[model samples]
Target: MPHNTIRTARCAALVGPYLAGKTTLLESLLFAAGAISRKGSVRDGNSVGDSAPEAKARKMSTEVNAASFEYLGERWSILDCPGSVELACESQNALMAADLAVVVAEAAPDKAVLLAPLFKFLDDRRIPHILFINKIDTLGDQSVRAVVSAYQEVSTRKLVLRAVPMREKGVVTGLVDLVSERAWRFNPHKPSNPVSLPDALKTDESEARQALLESIADFDDALLEKLLEDMAPDSDAVYDSLAQELANDQIVPVFFGSAENDNGVRRLLKALRHEGPEVAVTAARVDAPAQGAVAVQIVKTQIGSHAGKLSLARVWRGEVADGMILGGERVSGVFRLFGHEQTKIPTATAGDLVALGRLDKAATGDRLTDANGGKGNLGAPADWPERPAPVYGLALHAENRNDDVKLSSAIQKLTEEDPSLVLEQASDTGELVLWGQGDIHLRIAMDRLRGKFNVAVKGQAPQIPYQESIRKGTSHHARYKRQTGGHGQFADIQIDIRPLPRGSGIQFEDAVVGGSVPRQYIGSVEAGIRDAAARGPLGFPVVDFAVTLTGGQFHPVDSSDMAFKTAARQAIAEALPACEPVLLEPLLTVTIAVPSAFTPKIQRLVSGRRGQLMGFDARPGWPGWDEVKASLPQADMQDLIVELRSLSLGVGTYVWEFDRLQEAVGRAADRAVEIRREVLAAQ
Candidate 1:
């Protein structure tokens, strides 16, 4: 695809911190471009982008929403993405589909700090972007200037002023255009009426215009020569340089406006139409796909009411028809998504944001390409931000017993929509667990289960798998005899049990000599010993112990497998109590990365949670963060994450790997032993 061939001239994406009015801005743009008749607000629960029930309930965007509009003879495609840290990956995925990212910022200087991560992402990808200083009507001139300066201080690219706020009686009334040297005062109460710029902003307007021209002059030698000659540069030269620099991300033009009141929105739209990256130029893959084939990237996977699975894809090359093969399967249908509503379209071409219906095998970040019959590798661009590992988990089960099968299928669908969510069945404990980014992320996932899939579930904390082992060696004897029948049963055995090293698990050996016990019955005795060990004297699985059968006697005719098994079970049960059973708790090696300023607090938190700090290292790329490594009992880790998140303001991240199970002694171990013994006796 080429830039000149794109019907949609502009490809821009919106991103900012949570609740920064990104969706509202999109709504305003749509309304201005005539794509929508009336603008919808988030508070009213009627925004087009926030049509999902989960999004409406939370009043936040959980995924990317896209729409296109035409303004001033050029078509524009706009993508609105979630801003919450938990859903930040959605924004990254949107960026991959965008050529220019418009970072919306509030008037408050402190609020601008949240854009650091977004700026870093754009810079790393070498993606061009611009800044929109929004909500100027709410702040004074001095405050707005301070906020602008704060943004300039943080940004590596040149912050060029493309517009200046028109103030009237210490209030922002309109904006002065720096490029055209024109101004208009906005009537907030009556958006249809446009007031003239006040006389007092003349000097400020000139200064801003001069600064804008100087910033562009350095980019073109012709403009520099014209400036050296003390003459104004050609307007076309200035416009060309601005467009080229903005597209290349060398300069970020700041546009002043208030999205809520639609102040300067028209001017902003014109600037985007002129300065934004063309869809055809920007749609070229960051990394090209395989040749002689069409490839489309699925940026989002959304569940619909009656439409079922809708894959929001951007076609990079070629054309997709109703029945064209994608990923080796025929496409069911292609439709354009308008929230929950769908409009079927025939033959979507390159750079179209069309929804593919009934794409059961499609998922977010999947590349749908022409699949050749032969086995050949098709090189596709890597998906944006590899799926994040799930940090929090909950054990879940279907509330209705009959819904068990449906629950598994529903979970699979949810995972397909959001690949970051992880599902696992704990084979050791027979528990089903769902893992996600955080509490809210998991909550929304569960809500989707009941709301979208119509499957209800119950969730609870998983039981920590505990093990029991012996401490000291002990010997015992057992005998079994039956004389009620013609063929009587008789067996005698002596065994010794001892503790093994940690992680050694269970081991068995026999040293019986000279036909002390029949070899045929020895295997039966071992099976009986294992059955006894499955439920130790402490009511838990026994491990890290050795059992030896040193001597045994069996009658040739009377000794049966059952007789020897009973004798062996009785011998082990009798010997285990004398061995002084102890509890062994699973230990996890936990590593936490946090800012150094909070290192002391994190250390204290770990100690309070019964965790032993092993060591600490400085995080490589992060300046103030330190990685703290610790070993903590699995029982103590359940709620520790909640407290850790609270202390670190949700920035701290940690991962744990299972370590060896160790003997748990003292009061905790004693309590566990008592509980296990009570349970075993009851059983």
Candidate 2:
């Protein structure tokens, strides 16, 4: 094959904290690669990466945007992922398809802690990544080295500075490449111009370069020997070592620039071109088959207005052509995306990220293959990051009755695009609940529902699941007599009611003797008792009680199943209130996981929410973290995640399950009963 036709294809993902300029960096990369003539601005809502209406309105990326371009004879696909912590799932999914990742970061050292989870995720997956310190122009009076050191503290891997800032009068105007020994000054809207090294900064540059060399030498015995011998290594050899070490996940190379002004972007691209692994290496790393067989993994799914359902997938193996049979479905179209715009393509090969149309059955993270549908392993490592627990939830309902019919379908599409968003139908409350990482996350989902799917919904706090049970026992006699046109209905029964132990559930027994009531009518009586148990006197499901049928009378002709059932229901309804009914609140064993620094705050938070702290200990496998075990009322957990994040810089998380049902007491219990009474009255 000719060199022009035989192109090298690779992909990289951009990820970082909120407002870290990841989208801007993507725009800069596109401009530098000549894919776009002018760079688009996030502030102006013209950036290609954030083309969705919700993203443009909020000025933040809500989903992953994939774009492919050619630079210097090489084909590249860049996945620009959302930076918001709530949207981090988008980044996680996109990372599985990339050969490398470019982690963008803010220049402030104090905010370096925000990158803790992201760094841990990268390190845990052993995914090779490099750091891009963005917005360097805003680092007023802050030392870049200090920022680098702060980042190093969070990252488990060694952080190697690839360049040193060229500061003149305490302002960084350029950078000196440590490997190539070249200096370049930033030129806004144009490529950085090469400049001679300044004599004033020679000593600092040399020290920074020496530190970089030492960090690399730690992983290479030959490089260490050369360094110990006081020998200068060749520039090509140094670059090769850096690339090799980075690809091996042994060191993280750091670069700095302002993506808004397009500074240092070309240099970043050059580094990627030289160091990033090819598709073949990535395929092997994930254990994908070497032979070129049709295999694709759907990374994302979106329902387009004009194009219909589009599944964004990375072709992991053989060529995927339009109308090809894949996983029992025919591909409708193959499109290569340029931000929001897509161009129809005849075929896509290995390492190409393209959108396949009309694959309604294909969901995000689905591994698809040819008609055989064999050996499509998604290429995700065993420990791929799981979706974060929902920190916020809202009970949602359609604003218009007509939309209610379409609500479920719309939500399905929304979750199909973002697996992070969870939709639940509350079993007790019967409310449609939408759970997500935060308010912003849910808001974006709602926007997508309304804007894209034309579903407008009303949202409110989710309802707590509260139950009612009897505290005491009572016995009563009841009779049901009705006169009809021909046959009169008559039934009588005597029953004993008692409270059982918590979690024992409802129990029914027939202690009748001598056929006081026929065996057949006894079943009707039991059924009636159970039907009435669905709602106790306190307007909630009743549990932990027992009912015994002691005796009953039935007229042979006048008595029917309905009469016996009515008598049994009437007996329980009259006796339950007199039995000292009490409200039963759900108790959950909550294990609060957070950094040790915020353990005390978490304790206070639990106490304030009427929770009992059982104990606390170091969280297993997570250093400097603690898990506080507490028994908390279900009512207090509605906003726990919101408060937890506010206290722990968004790193705190917890797991909880129903432990038992405990009797609610004090004014809280009284308030709950009163509110439930009002709700029942309204219904």
Candidate 3:
């Protein structure tokens, strides 16, 4: 898109930890912009952004919701994202679509630490942002400074004061504008009331002004020179430096207010209108391919009401109209997404965020472009963060037998919506497994499965897949003789079994003497040994073992392949018990990344789970967060994340990979072996 032609619809994403009032802030902004008549509280369940039934029940956003408001004649697209760490991916996706972010933090210093991961994410992405010190009505003046200092100590960027708390007898009434050097007071109970500048704030206002000037001077050489000469810098110079420093993400402009009470909301909106999107840096564009037509990038995807799939796209350089050809396919229609509602737009231009309806094949990272003679691969930038792998799994089965086909179809659609979800059929276990990031992520997927597609499924933790292997060498002999009136079948076989190295799998070798067993009979003996390996002495699939057909005898006319095979299988079964078999449980290489404060707790938890800590390393740019590497049994891994998240205050993150199956030969392993024996006997 041409720099001048592209409408600058810079977006600001409201994001924080759970219950931080992100949706409420959006509601406040919508009312402040006159987009709505009255503000709707989340408790009332009438908020525009949180219309989904799940969101209404939880009273929190579960996905990204956007609304556009015209402030100072400039279009600002505000995205309200979910705050729950379970839905952090939604916030990250919103951040990718936005040019800047507004991190809302509680006034309490302890609670303010929740913004650490988000701040690091924005810093790494180079997204400029402002800090809204919310819930000031609950904190005293001294507490507010303590919270500010706590944030400054943790944040790498300077936290410059853009607005100071307006006080009356030590009670915060409103905020004093530092740049404007004016006192503004608003009714804390009623946010829409016009704020009045109070004279009682004069002394504090002067100190705030000087603090703001000195902070700006630290960045601007000219302002520093003016400060040295004891001459105040021009207001334009101060604002210019503020804008430049904020745009470069060198400074995080801080404003104090209470979102719930609506105090300082109007001023915050005014500040955003003047300094937010208007000064946002444009996203870097990818150089267009020579022969391909204009391309549009799809940043988000939504399943709309009564609508199939909505591909939320931003046109980089193209005009899309109804029935227009794109990527050799016809553009069905372009529409704007208003919360959960969709409005059909006749045409969508470059830089406009629109929902392309009925794009079932389209995905979150897909690119739509005019095809050059029906041949070209125009796609969005592929350098974005890779989706997390699914480490947790659940076994799912449909309740109604008739809904089996429907269940399969629903699972496919659900997987499409969330690329992180992985579906697989266990070949050995013959069970359907749904894998996801964590327990909550998988539960949400299951909820969508039932709610969106009406596919009722029973979910449970999957059974641990265990293997049986031998520990010592043993030999046994078997003979099969059957009499059937005229002809008789007879065969004799001897087999030797031995344990192989871990993960070596099963191997069969024929070491029969020249005339002891026929060539055809030797093949049958090997097949029988392979079949016996399927269900070892413990009834679980055998692994990491080898078998050899040492010697066997076959009657020329009476002994057939079936006779030799049956005899060999019986011999191997007899040899397995004497071979001293053991059970092998799957081990997982679990890597947990958590705040340093919780390291000791995590180590203790790992120890309790019988895990071995391999090492610990620091996570780059994230102070007080350590990456802990450990190897844990797969069975112990269940619900381990729940404890970790609780310990780390939801900032904990982890990824696990399958290591190898090792012998589990203690009391627990014996119990598993006993259970397998009972199950096999019953079968």
The lDDT per prediction is 0.77, 0.87, 0.76
- Write the residue-wise lDDT of candidate 1 on 1-683 in tens digits: 33344455445789987777888888888877787888898888898787788899999887788776556555567889887767777788778777788888888786554665577678767678878877777686565567778777557778888887766688887777777777777765234344565677788877777888888877778888887888977666787899888877788888878888887777778788777767556655365355436777777777754567877877776777898778766678988656556777677777667788777776687777775741222423654676666667789888898999999999988887887789999875678999877777788888889998888888776767788889898888899898876998888988888899988877889889998988988888888888888777777788888989899888888999999898988888888878888888999999987767678887798888778999899977554568999999887876666777677655566888999798788887777767667755785
Q: Quick one: RMSD of model 3?
A: 3.4
Measured by TM-score, the strongest candidate is: 2
* Model 1, C-alpha of 602: deviation from truth (Å): 2.7
Off by over 4 Å in 3: 1-8, 188-203, 278-280, 285-294, 304-306, 371-377, 380-382, 481-491, 674-683
Winner by lDDT: 2
RMSD of each: 4.1, 2.1, 3.4
For candidate 2, the TM-score is 0.96
**What is the per-residue lDDT of model 3 for residues 514-610, given as tens digits with 9 covering 90 to 100?**
7788887888888887887888888798888888888878887789989888897888778888888888899999999887888888889899997
Looking at model 1, which ten-residue stretch has the lowest summed lDDT? 374-383
Q: After superposition, how far is residue 547 of candidate 3 from its true place, in Å?
A: 0.7
The local lDDT score (0 to 100) that residue 72 gets in candidate 2 is: 84
TM-score ranking, high to low: 2, 3, 1
Whole-model lDDT, candidate 1?
0.77
TM-score of each: 0.86, 0.96, 0.91
Residue-level error in angstroms, candidate 1, position 354:
1.0
